[model samples]
Target chain A: MAELSKTDQVEDLHLVNLTKRFGEVAAVDDLTLTIPAGSFFALLGASGCGKTTTLRMVAGLEDPTSGSIRIGDKDVTRLRAFKRPVNTVFQSYALFPHLDIFENVAFGLRRRGVKNIKPIVEAMLELVELGHLARRKPTQLSGGQQQRVAVARALINKPDVLLLDEPLGALDLKLRRQMQIELKRIQTEVGTTFVHVTHDQEEAMTMADTIAVMNAGRIEQMGSPAEIYELPRTVFVANFLGQSNLIEGRVSGAGEMLDVAAHERSFRLPRERSSATGASIILGVRPEKMTVLDAPDAARVPEGHNVLSGRVTDVSYTGVSTQYLVQASWGQELVVFEQNLIVGDRCEVGDEVVVHWSPRHSFGLDGNEDIHAGVDSAVLALESVDSAPAAGDGE
Target chain B: MAPVLPSAAVAPPSTVAQRRSRTGYVLLFPGMTWLAVFFAIPFVTLFVTSLQTPVPGKSGRYQLGLEFGNYATALAEYWPAFVRSFAYAGIATLLALIIGYPLAYFIAFRSGRWRGLMLVLVIAPSFASFLLRTYAWKTILADESPVTSFFNALHLLPDGRILNTSIAVIAGLTYNFLPFMVLPLYAALERIDPRLIEAANDLYASPVTAFRKITWPLSMPGVVAGTLLTFIPAAGDYINAELLGSTKDRMVGNAIQTNFIEFRDYPTASALSFALMAAILILVFTYIRRAGTEDLV
Candidate 1:
């Protein structure tokens, strides 16, 4: 812990108009972002979305085709990876196969000519709860233990910024969850800026203090996890972060509360929540925000709630919440998630239902963009865990 | 009924296991027979021959009596040749490693699409007969050739000649066994994950430091395998010395060949051959132990 406190000066990481191109294709297009000092920030995106590339550029592993990177007042765009004040926990862990866990953790210190390294390495290993396994080679340890060693290897260096490129991608679901919490705890203890790159929305939301959603090498939205999830500015962000029911609508009026017309019915969207200035818009609402009521219970619906009538096309009775796909009169399907609190009031498939949510829960985006922009990629990201190449970022 | 059922299941699996083991023995029969006939019997014959004493005053004739003194006399007389053989082979192996490692590293990490062509080129020289290749070097390093003339102009050749010298024999040995050095090194180096090197670099290691810390250690298997492949055969090879070297550079292989073919000293030749094998085995065992590559090899 004393060794971790050596980095007393906290510095923000800034990527100013960074671009990396592989021949004709721009892997990371003109991107600019500022990660605040000492925050657990996440670059959330699907595979090949340039999130890993951005992390590598910050780590100085990959040189930017254009633009500069800065840590506090120092511009480090031309610095070599070893010379930079940054270290990366690679996606594959990439632990030194020949070195045991202790030597692996002490590698950076030894390279920098640190005279006394045993106590620092021991403390770092203890922080990762891997002190007993310090004598083991990377292959001798299980996946989770090796992952923590990878973290300790990078963390002991105490760089101004620690870049994580899908560091937990190789773990199984349960281990991934556990490591996410473990990594967050370590990051909090060290108080170093941790920029995590991942494609899992839940992992990003659970661990990161701020999230920047990347799409095709650009930041689509950057905010706190809740801010991006609740008020996504683009169709890609709206669909990529989580499932959203986007209804094509027209903004007939505007003010503190803007009026929208869709499927021959009027709906209200809070003015500040809308990112669209034109008449054409896409109204987005989270599935969990909408309440699914049987057609018979429509009379019990509260006032000031936007209502739509549909028949339940699908009902998935998951333990915590029942997800319902409601096909509206316009033939567009909208999903609604209802908590499984009242078991007898469940809406079976094919039941006629009314979906209602308050105007505060809905956000509006430009209608011109593709409504399914990030939908397929989000599903693909979920299905293909760790399928992305560990070495080649954004390839 | 429960005991009977468990025994019945155990009985079938045990029978199956016996049958599998029997099949394995049957499958191993051909290989065992081949080794016994080709390797084991010849080795036993050689060992017996090494102990035979020559009939007094009769050239190429030997008695069936055990004469372990043949080994003592062989080592006593030709110990210089043995030393020369090991030194020349050691030097050649070292030179090949120095030249082959960077080539192998390039082929594995940096050559990209050209790696296949480079590997083919490494083995291409072996397509010709090894004797022909050694003879080609003799011509290349002859007194009137460009190589000799160039070295003579630079005063690099001590005796104003490149052929009929220890340098020529060592060079020939190095050239002939280089592919053996390169191929194993290439395999081991190529199998290393590139990310490990990048990880080293990211952890504040310069490129050179990364190579020392990560690349060199990981490729130790290749180094051990390549050096053994080059050194072992080079030590016992007579072709290079016969063609490129003079009497002063004669190695143990030359002594064994002359004792067997020309001098008709079967006991001495057999003794020399067995001694060479024993020496190589000891050296390679110690080397493997020192390199700590039991698991890797």
Candidate 2:
């Protein structure tokens, strides 16, 4: 183990082409990432997408089949979990039930043969705002309180990096959101690199400085939250982060101005966002970016806009916004989210409407890729598991 | 969120609930009565027997009275047997714990699909008669047995004779009660979440330290239960001492048995039995207190 003094400074966590194989299945395959010191990075993926497996590999809980892990200048690939300068806030909290909150937080320090850790643990508890409950056992606290203690327990060790494996998974929705904010605050205050693995897209977007979207044991995209949301490069990334309306089109013009013809309509694309000139592509647009208009007022669309006339198949009022499913006359249904400022202009199902958006609001993806490739694996897995019983009942 | 309602409106419902609770007590009556008859009645008889006055010249004749001096006589005459009984039981329990803890840990965590088979193997010995098993140990530890001969040749045994000794009695006790120790330990260790151990490792505790700070402490409930299971029976046991031990190794159970069946000294036997029970109870209470596991039961 490297001397503790040498590891005092913040160190970047690096995973170099790590691969973990369980039997014939690869859980995490050739995953390489460098999380800069003091950055909150998220590995976002649905269940079985290798996000948790990657985090466990970095935490030294799981041994990679090949490749190395480094913290700062030290190679800790073969190091025992205890010898590494890292800690994790487990999803179950995993707090020592036999110990009080103070002792649970002080456990790591005491294990390293450090005495007089009372003040350090007390300060950490205060940072997590759990100082008042120091004397209570973990079982006595609420789930959220215990979660904070798990965080404090890891943070008090002052490791080079902190790994959180879906730390808010067990909490209720409200508590999860509150703790998301709390986690960000603690990360900022401690200035420790945090590698948070979660399937919640909103959580990743809200808390992470950078997020790597993983799928099928590989990273689909890695970028800032806004960058990932604004310009998803793959069908998976475009669909996984949020709802994206994809319209198949072929690039008809290239150079300073690009044009795409799809569904018997010509749409202009921004020059800077042009892909292969002659290739078929899928134009992507956010639900909120598409505006819905009454079909009778189709001429209201501006000249430089991409427009499609359709009938409203579904209209869902959701407080701040109303979602409209507009089925274009030529084919395909597109989702549009309109602000609910004018309640009097609400459109019912089967109402004729026109959906239009500016050229800049859209991005393009390879038309060859499966449009539903990035749908949540959790939902897909549940469907398969439910299929057996459903088939039995049918028989 | 709902406000408190008037007690008058709640009284009718609570009256029916109270009647249901009475039915629950009625359902419990048969089992409670059976315990009172079979267990409580015998205990009272035993307590009275412990205080009986034995007729000076009549064999097996005792008059019920406050003859507390019988307890003094039993203690004064058989103090060594009482002490030896506890020492043997304590040593056997300790040995069982030492051997069973790792066995249980392996069966619980490392056995994988073999866990069921391993558990069956641990419990398989209890299928046979305990007396038959103790006699089997007698043959194994005999001077001419291969095990004893091997030990003699290896100089592990100073003398080739082990059949009629304290070591043989303790060995018999340990062997007989091993499953009792292993099962409870396995149950407790199995219930522990593996993540707690991994979390300990992530927090910079070495495997040994993790065991000490997490695994061992969490397994205390099982340790307490297993030790009590092994020790309580081993303390009252006479078959092992009679089958494998000499007169010098005779325990309190053997003395009580001899007094009751051979000497016909019912008062003395009852006194010795009561003393053993009282001692075990006190020791167990002190132990549970010291181990800080009173809540386990």
B1-297 per-residue lDDT for model 1 (tens digits): 223554544655666889999999999999999999999999999999999987888767998868889999999999999999999999999999999999999999999899999999999998899988998998899999999999999999889998999999999999999999999999999999999989999999999999998899889999999999999999999999999999999999999999999998898999999999999999999999999986542
Clashes of each: 0, 0
> TM-scores of the models, in the given order?
0.95, 0.92
Give one digit per residue, the lDDT tens place, for model 2 in A1-395: 11112225898888899999999999999988889998999998878888898888888899999989999899999999999889999988998998899999998898888877777787788888888999898888888888899998998888889999988877766677788999998888778899998887888989999999999789998999999898888888888888889888887675666778887888877766544334788888999998888888899998889988889998898898999999898779889999987858677899998889999988877777887877666355334323322111110
| Distance from true location, Cα of B275 in model 2, Å | 1.3
lDDT of 1 by residue, A285-360 (tens): 9999999888999997888899999999998988989989999989998888888888476888899989999999
Candidate 2: list runs displaced more than 4 Å.
A1-8, A271-278, A341-348, A376-395, B1-17, B295-297
Superposed Cα deviation of residue A59, candidate 1 (Å): 1.6
What are the lDDT scores of the predictions, listed in order? 0.91, 0.87
lDDT of 2 by residue, B145-260 (tens): 99888888888765557899898999999999999999999999999999999999998889998999889999999999999999999999999999999999999999999999
